[model samples]
Target: MILTVTLNTALDITYRVPRLRPHASHRVTEVTERPGGKGLNVARVLAALGHEATVTGFVGGGTGRALRDRLAAVDGVSDALVPVSGPTRRTVAVVDESTGDTTQLNEPGPHVSPAEWAAFQEAYAGLLGSASAVALCGSLPPGVPVGAYATLVRAARAASVPVLLDTSGEPLRRGVAARPDLVKPNAGELAELTGSHEPLQAVRDTRRRGAHAVVASLGARGLYALTPDGEWRAPAPDRLAGNPTGAGDSAVAGLLSGLLDGEDWPRRLARAVALSAATVVAPAAGEFDAGTYEKLLARVSVDRVTS
Candidate 1:
């Protein structure tokens, strides 16, 4: 089983518009909603790949209930979310049909009380006992300590479970100190964390900061991984065009799935790159076309980096 922690879960709403113009009003052609946040996205992708995933984090009020209801309907995912007094937040993604661009409006999640935080910690610890691997993902919600991921990483390590962390800013900085087995940061997040825009330099700096290994997501270029065994650059066969919102989370699912199967780094990178590309072409976030994934998996190229 895989354990995924989302500190700030959300009801993700996507709106399709004919065109987005500044200071203009238009009818929304379509609306779709789903349980979201990076970890939830990862869990959804993992479940799609036939892995049992447990999602834990804070949720409350009407929106939270709605999110949980959807989770209950989804197969292969268990909801272990802790309740808070404040209502869960929502994120709106306005997608332009003409240009395939997205305009995003996000709400800060519910304020978590100290009591809720404690309850979450206890629940997470119990889940870790049965988890084959764990992923700590996304932003820290209000009233939650910045070191939350660090603490959770430590607990996973204590249980002898390999953990993957995907976050940004101070939370990521602190979490790295716990020496997680792996850290996945997109290029921008890597730059913000290490002050280097260059992918190779940034990943190395992040590793020096404490992560045992670092996998840098370079958007459509694919993934650059620096691990104990060596380094490798995995590139997509072709630049895919579509919604890339959940591509990173899909990659996270790939890495965890590969880890569980005891696959080598090259295979892991291939799976991740293929999954990410598949998500790019999928109709929605946290989803992929099985046929595309199968085709891309064999096409993804993994080349070792020697310096």
Candidate 2:
């Protein structure tokens, strides 16, 4: 089983409109709500792909209850959400149909007290014991230490479970010091961490910062993996477009799914690239088109980088 941690869970609301006009209201043709936060998104994708995934983190109040109930509806996904006193957060994504671009508005997330943090640590320790691998995703909420993910990485190491971290800013900086087995960061986050927008160079520097391997999500340029085996780049399929929200999370799900199956390293890169492309083609945010994923998986090209 793969255990995923999300410190700030949310109920994500996605809206689709023909175009986004500043200071003007438009009729939204669609609105979809789901249990979200990065880890939940990963669990959803893994479940869709027939992987057993357990999600655990801080969930609060009425929103938390709704989030858990909704997640339970997705087959093959399980949750061990730690209940907190506050309300779960809400994230909004506005999709422009004409250009297939998405503008996101996110809430900062709820406050987690020290007691709640302790409760989470207890739950996590138990989850780590049985999990084949662990993924620490998304941002930290209030009252949680900035280095919280770093601590989680340490615990996963002690249990001998490979840890995959997908986060940003200080949490990422701290977590890297623990030398996680894998770290996936999008280009913007990668730039923030290493001050290099050049994808390969950034990934190489990120590897030097203690990620055993660095997989940089280059958006439409597809996926790049820098590991002991070598560096591989897979570009996303062209001539297809849609909302790009959650593509990175879906890619993480794909790569981790491959890892759980004991797939060869190159195959893992292919899986990540394929899923990410499928996610871009999906009209809805955070969900991938299953058909597209299957097709992209077959055509994704993986080539080694000499340097």
Candidate 3:
């Protein structure tokens, strides 16, 4: 089973409008809500890929309850979230139907007390015992330590579980030093961490910082990976038009699943790129269209990068 940790879980709400106009109200065409956060999104994708996934994070209040309710309905994923006093947050994504653009509004999650933080750590440790691989993902909530992911990475390593980290800013900086098995960062995050906009150089600098392997998402160009085994660039077959939200999480899922299956780096990159592209074309946030994924999987080209 795969374990996913999301410290700042959220209820993802999406709104569709004919077109977004400045200072003008538009009629809403559709609305959808789901449980979200980088880790939870990864869990959902992992479940869809025939993996048993368990999600543990902080959740509270009506919004948290609603998120859990939706999570319970997902078939292959199990909920192991810890309860918190502060209410969970909500993220709003407004999609412009005409242009296929998305505007996102995010809320800072509830403040977590020290007691709640302790409880979550204990819960996470317990979950790791049964997890084949673990993913520590997303932003830190109010009052959680900045070194939270670093701490979690240490625990996973001590437990002999392969861990993947997907986050940004200071948390990611610290987490990378913890020497996670894998780290996936998008273009901007990579540049921020390594202070270099060059993908190859940035990934190399990132690995030197302590991550055993680094996979940098290059948006439509697909993924660039630097690992002890080798380096490779996997590019998407074509850019599909849809919401690009959750594409990175899907890529994380792909990489984790491939790791457990013991596939080579090239195959793992192909899977990650295909899943990311599929998520872009999906109608809802954090979901991948199965047909699109299968169709693109064989087409994703993985070219070895010679240093």
Q: Residue 214 error for model 3, in Å?
A: 0.4
Q: Is candidate 1 or candidate 3 better by lDDT?
A: 3
**In model 1, which runs have C-alpha deviations exceeding 4 angstroms?**
none
Error of 2 at 307 (Å): 3.4
Residue by residue across 46-139, what tens digits does model 2's lDDT show? Answer: 8888889999999987878888889889888888999989889888889898986778898877789999999999999999999998999999
How high is the CA lDDT of each candidate model?
0.92, 0.89, 0.93
Scanning candidate 3 in windows of ten residues, the lowest lDDT window is: 235-244
Candidate 3 regions exceeding 4 Å error are 22-29
Q: How far is each candidate from the true structure, as Cα RMSD in Å?
A: 1.2, 1.8, 1.3
How close to the true structure is residue 227 of candidate 2, measured as C-alpha lDDT? 94
For all predicted structures, in order, the TM-scores are: 0.97, 0.94, 0.96
lDDT of 1 by residue, 1-307 (tens): 9999999999999999999998999899999999999999999889989999999999999999989998899899999898889999999999899998899999999988888899999999999989999999999889999999999999999999999999999999999988999999999999999999888999999999999989989986789999999999997657587878888999999999999989999999999999988998988766887899999898888999999
